[model samples]
Structure formats: structure tokens, C-alpha cells
Target: MPIKFEIGDIVHLKKNHPCGGNIFEIMRIGMDFRLRCSTCNKQLWLERTEVERRLRKHFRNDEEIKS
Candidate 1:
């Protein structure tokens, strides 16, 4: 099954970013996704398929969604 992600979801990638951060926050999602790096606060745009392939894990805590 394809992974389902929502805006504000926190995700860990299979590889670290150039800034050495593996964590990213989902800012937007569509055919493409916008992500913000956890450590550097840098933003990136990636295709949905690429993001799905690179995703290692995702956090969708109920508490986070409520905030």
C-alpha cells in the first residue's frame, strides 16, 4: 500500500540531507511535496514518487495534529 502523509507530518528520510539532517516536516503535498529540514530549516521540493521512495519513517502524532 502507498503511504499516506498529511501536511505537518514529521518524516525521516533514508539518507541525511547536505546539512546532515534526516528529519523533515511536510509543508505541502500534491504531485510534488514541499519539505522543511529539521536542522537547517532549509526548504526543498521533491516529487511524490521520490519522496515516497526516500521516506524511512513518518510521525503523525495525534497531539501534533491537534496543535
Candidate 2:
């Protein structure tokens, strides 16, 4: 099954960037996904297929989305 994520959901990515962070925010969704690094503020676009493969986990609570 494909993993699903929603806007404002906090997620951990499969790989960590050089900044030593793997967390990202699901800013946009569609044929492509737009993500923002939780630690470095870096943003990038990824294919939905690729994102599904790399999604590590979804936030269990809404605390992170409050901001």
C-alpha cells in the first residue's frame, strides 16, 4: 500500500541531508510534492511516487502543526 500524508503533517524522510536532519513538512501535494526542511528551511519538489517510497513516518499528534 502507498503511504499517505496530509498538508501540515510532520514527517521524517528516508535520508538525512548534510545538515543532519531528516524531518520535513508536507507543504504541497499532487503529481509533485513540495517539502520544507524542518531544520534548515530548505525546500524542494519531489515526485509523488518518490515521496511515497521515502516517507518514513507520519506525525501521531497535531502539536507540530499548530505553528
Candidate 3:
């Protein structure tokens, strides 16, 4: 099944940031995904194609937390 991520879902990218973190949070989802670095609070935009290609894993789902 294809992995689907939504806003507020935490994810780990394929590569670590210069700040030594690989984790990010989904801020927006569309043609491009907007992400905020979990460690440094830096915001970045990644194309959906690139996101699917570079996404390493999904961590926490906001929906799951409410249940």
C-alpha cells in the first residue's frame, strides 16, 4: 500500500540535516509538502515526488494520538 501522510504527522527523511536531525513534521500537503525540522524549527518545502522518493519512515500520526 502507498504510504499516506497528513498534516501534523511526524516523519523521518532519508538524510540527516546539517543540524544532525532527520526528523520533520508535515505542515502542508499538496503538490509540494511543507515540513518543519523537528530539531531546528526550520521550514522547508519539498515536492510530493521528492517527498515520496526521500521519505524514510513515518513516526507519529496526530489522528492516532486522539484515539
Estimate TM-scores for all models. Answer: 0.86, 0.77, 0.79
Residue 34, candidate 3: Cα error in Å is 0.6
TM-score of 3: 0.79
- In model 2, which runs have C-alpha deviations exceeding 4 angstroms? 63-67
lDDT of the candidates, in the order given: 0.86, 0.78, 0.80
Q: Write the residue-wise lDDT of candidate 2 on 1-67 in tens digits.
A: 5555678778777988678889888899888999899899998898988887787677835543221
**Residue-by-residue lDDT tens digits, candidate 3, 1-67:** 4467778888877988789888899999988899999999999998988877787777664433321
RMSD (CA, Å), each prediction = 4.2, 4.6, 4.0
Better by TM-score, candidate 3 or 1: 1
lDDT of 1 by residue, 1-67 (tens): 5578899999888989999999999999999999999999999999988888888777897333222
Structure candidate 2, residue pairs in collision: none
Candidate number that wins on TM-score, 2 or 3: 3
Best by lDDT: 1
Q: What C-alpha lDDT does candidate 2 achieve relative to the native structure?
A: 0.78
Q: How close is candidate 2 to the true structure, as a TM-score?
A: 0.77
